[model samples]
Target: MQSANLQKQKLELIEKIIHTDDQNTLDFLKSILNDETSDYELTDEQKQIVEEATAKYYSGEEPSFTWDEVKNNIRKRNFQD
Candidate 1:
């Protein structure tokens, strides 16, 4: 997209946000704007899992699933009704 179009879309979004009366919507926007990576802390076990996953990803030692495959797998596992 062009920069001009991006700026126009942003302005439209800002206008919509300004006119929105829902407190939940406003709070969501505020949280999104204020959110930072530093706000999240991972436990030691979670960190170890992430490091292992990262290594496997970089080394191509594990297979990957497409979005469709992942969703289908989840449905098969969890939505057996």
Candidate 2:
């Protein structure tokens, strides 16, 4: 309900932006759109770490925790120091 209204408002704002003749505003909007659509590139070391984690997960070498346990652990850590 609230989400639908927000979506409608976004569409209305976008329509207004589309009809604008301001070059600076249009260029700023284009840059923002490009940034949003761009893919995130990870460094080699970061990629290696992600690959290692993926391998561990697929090899059943990674420890898995339930959502409730994870939340409880987070709460404990947050409350403690």
Candidate 3:
């Protein structure tokens, strides 16, 4: 099928779906349209962080923290009555 025809079909289908399931269809459309491609551009710091994580994973040197360690840290932060 041609791209134009496909787009028209999609629009018609979306309209029908919206009419039948207004809230869900609106939410789906909102989610689809809310994506700001430009805003998702990664910063230099984020890029470096991703690179570091990738390097750690590839080098088999990723740091591992246990659940007990997390619980202990959180417990220490709590003040007992």
Assess every candidate by TM-score.
0.46, 0.46, 0.35
Q: In candidate 1, where is summed lDDT lowest over 10 consecutive residues? A: 31-40
Q: How many Å off is the CA of 38 in candidate 3?
A: 5.3
Model 3, residue 5: distance off in Å is 31
Per-residue lDDT of model 1, residues 1-81, tens digit only? 579989999999999998999998987788889882335689999999999999998899998889999999999989786
Q: Which segments of model 2 are wrong by more than 4 Å?
A: 1-35
| Residue-wise C-alpha lDDT for candidate 2, range 1-81, written one tens digit per residue | 579889999999889998999998887788897876635699999999999999998899998789999999999999997
Full-model lDDT for every candidate? 0.89, 0.89, 0.79
Q: Locate the minimum summed-lDDT window of 10 residues in model 2.
A: 31-40
Candidate 2 has a TM-score of 0.46
Off by over 4 Å in 3: 1-29, 33-38, 63-81
Model 3 steric clash pairs: none
lDDT tens per residue, model 3, 16-61: 8767756866766677789734335888999999999999988889
